[model samples]
Target: MTVSRARLALGALILVAATAVLTYAATVNVYVQRLETRLDAFGEVADHPVFRRLLDVIGYVRRFYVEEVPLDQLLEGAVDGVLQSLDDPYTVYYDAEAYESFEISLTGEYEGIGVVVTTVDEYVVVQTPFPGSPGATTYPDNHDGVSPPGLRAGDRILEVDGVSVVGMPVERAASLIRGPRGTTVRLTVERPVEGAPPQVLYFTIRRQSIEIPTVQQADMVTPRIGYLWLTQFTPDTPGQVREALKRLRDQGARAIILDLRNNPGGDLSASVQVASQFVPAGPVVHVERRGGERETYSARGGGLGLPLVVLVNGGTASASEIVAGAIQDYGSGTLLGEQTFGKGSVQTVYTWEDRQGRAAVKVTTARYLTPKERSIHAVGLTPDVEVPGTPEQQGDPQRDPQLRRAIELLEQRLGG
Candidate 1:
C-alpha cells in the first residue's frame, strides 16, 4: 500500500513538470514569431537598394564603431535628415525640449528674463522687455561701473553665462537665457551709444514666470479716438480686445486705431475673432489646401460699427495679415504704415509619442488668401497710407509718424 501511494505521488509530479515545459516552449515560439514578422517587414524595405544600403551602414556601425552609439540618437538623426532634405524653412521637427518650448509659446507664458530678442546683423539683440519684469527693472552699478540696471532695446547680447553668443541664432540665444523661475542668468551686453564708443555692460537678471500681454497699450488717443496696440494674437487676445473696445467706447471714443506694428501674428482663431469685432458679416479670408480645396472663413456679425483704421508694418505677419486683409477687403478700416511681413502660409502642428518621449512636426499645410482672392505669400499687403516707422521712432509716441498718420485718418473720419 505504501509503494502504490509513493508511485501515485511521483506520477503527479512528472505530469506537472511536463506541463511547465510545454508552456515555456509555447511562449518562446510566440516571441520568435513576432520577431520574424518584424524582419519580414524589414525585408520588404530591404528590396530597395537605397534602404539596403542604409541598413548595411547601420549594421556596420553597430559592429565596428569606435564609440558606442545609442540607437535612439541614430534614429533621431535619420529623421532630422529626412526633414531637412525637404529644405522648407517653415516645416521643422521639434525634439522633446524644443517641443515643450513651442507649446509654452502658444500659451503666451514662459519662464525667462522677460526680454524679447531678434537676430540683428547676426547678433541677438533685445527688442523689448515686458513691463515690471526683471529685464524691465533697473539694476545698480555693475562690477564694471556701468550704472544701468535693466536691459534696453537694441542692446546686442555678447554672452550668456560666459558662453559667447556671437553669430548664434536668436532662438538659441533666447533658449539659453531662459531657465527655471527665480534662477539668475548672467548677460554681457554691448550698448551702442551715439557719439561714443560702444559700452560693454554686464547684468545678472532673475528669471520669472512671465505672462505676455497680447495688447500692449490701450487708451483714448483723443476724446473721440481710441488707440489699441496689439502685440500679438494669442488665445486671450479677443477677450482683451473686446474689453479694451468697450472701455474706449465708454470713454466716448467714436473711432479706433488698431496698431498691429511689429506684431508677429499667432493663433488664427484669435485673429478671426478680433476681425469679427469690426468687419461686417462676410467672408474674411480663404484657405487653399494642396489638393485645390478651398474654405472660406466669415465674420460673426454685430460689430461695434465704429470707424476703424488698422496700423501695420513690415513686422506684421501671419494672422495679423489675415486680420488686415479682411478689414481692407470689406472696407471696414483703412490700413496705415509700410507693407506687411507677407507670411500668408498656415502651419499645422502634429505630435506623436515615441520611446524617447514626444516629438512634434510643424508643416506648412495651406496658403491663405485675402477675401478678394489675392495671394500675399511673398507680396505683402500695401497700406492705404504708406507711412514709415523708423527704428528711432519706435518707442517714442510723440515721434511715431505711423501712429500720427493713423490718428490723422481716424480724426478725419470722425470729422474731429
Candidate 2:
C-alpha cells in the first residue's frame, strides 16, 4: 500500500488521499508515524484544544488498541475523516501508482480489454467497447482461445477475474480490469432488460494494446455533410480533426457534424486549440480564479467557417462544453441533442511526497464561463434542438435520434 497525505485545505479544512487497484495507498499507519515525532511540527497549533484532543485520541489508540494496530492505518483514517468534511468530489487525492494509471487512461490507449465504463448510481456500467478491441464483437483475437459475446451498453459489471467488485470505486474497478497485453481476464456482467429479468453473462477476454482515438469516427454522412465523432480533447486532437476535415473535404463534404456526446474533457490547453480550429478569432473561454484573477484564452485566426451541427448529451462536459458553449455563443454552429454534463470548474493536478511515498491531488483552482459570460458550473448547455435518446441506438448509427435530427437539419440547410 502506497499511503498518501490527502489532507485538504478548505476555507480551511483538511483530509487524506486514496490509493489504487482496490489496494488503497499506504494505511493509517502513516498517521501513527506523523504523530510519533512531528507533534512539535504543528508549532503554535499544537497548543490548540482541537489539536490537543486529536493528540489524546492518537495517544490512546497507540497505547490501548488490541492486537497492535498498524502504524499507518490510523493516519489514513485521519486523512479519510478530513475528506468527509469537504464537499467537493473533484478535490480528492491519488497515490503515485494510482496517479500513473489515471494518466494512462486519458491518453486514448492502453493495455486492456478496450472498453469505456462509468459508475452511475453505484452501478458499474459499460458505456461502450472500443471498436475492434477484444471487448467489441467486431473483431476476433489472434489467440485462438475461447471468446464470449463482446460487452454491451448497460451491462452491469459484477465481478472481475472471480473477485467481486460490487462496491468498488470506478477507478479501482477499471484498474482491476486492465492488465498487460496477451493476458486474459474474466468478467461477469448482468444484462438489464426493460421489462423482464436481467440475464447474467460471462466473458473471458484476452487483454490487448487498446488504442481509443480521440476522434472515434470520421466520414462523409452525405454528399456534402462530413461527420466527426470526438471522444476527447487531447493534444493530438487538433491535428486529427484537421486531417479528418481535409479527408471529408476531399470527399466533397461542405458541411460538418461535430459529435461531442459522451466526451469527458481533458487538457484545458487542448480544448482551446480544438476550439480554434472551428470558431473564428475571438475569446474561446474565460477562466476566473479564487483571488478574482481572470484570464481569457482566445482562438487563433484562420479556421473553417463551414455550416456546423454539434451533437451533445449529458456526457459532453468540461472542454467539450467549452467548445459547444463558444459555438453557441457565436452562432457558429447549431447545438443539437440533449443538454450537456455541467462541469465548469477547473481542477489543478499536482503531486507531493511523504515519509512513506508520493501522492497526487486534484484541487479546484478556477471557474470558467462561456464567451458570453454565462456561468455553467452546475447548469449545462441546452441545445438549439432538443432530441431525447432511445435504447439500442449504439448498435446502429442510423438509429441515433440525435444524429437523425442533425442530418435532417443539415439536409434542410443544404437544400437536399
Please report the candidate that would top TM-score against the real structure: 2
Tens digit per residue, CA lDDT, model 2, 54-136:
65576577679887876456655665455435545445456556667766776677999887675545567775565557886
lDDT of each: 0.71, 0.71
Pick out the ten consecutive residues of candidate 2 with the lowest summed lDDT. 19-28
Off by over 4 Å in 1: 1-48, 57-68, 113-174, 181-208, 302-304, 390-396
Weakest ten-residue segment in model 1 by summed lDDT: 18-27
Task: Please list the Cα RMSD from the true structure of every candidate, rounded to 1 decimal place.
Answer: 14.0, 7.7
Model 1 RMSD vs true structure: 14.0
User: What is candidate 1's lDDT per residue for 264-380, written digit by digit as tens?
Assistant: 677777888888998888787898888899988888877669888888876677788899999998888899888876778777765555566765566677889988999997678
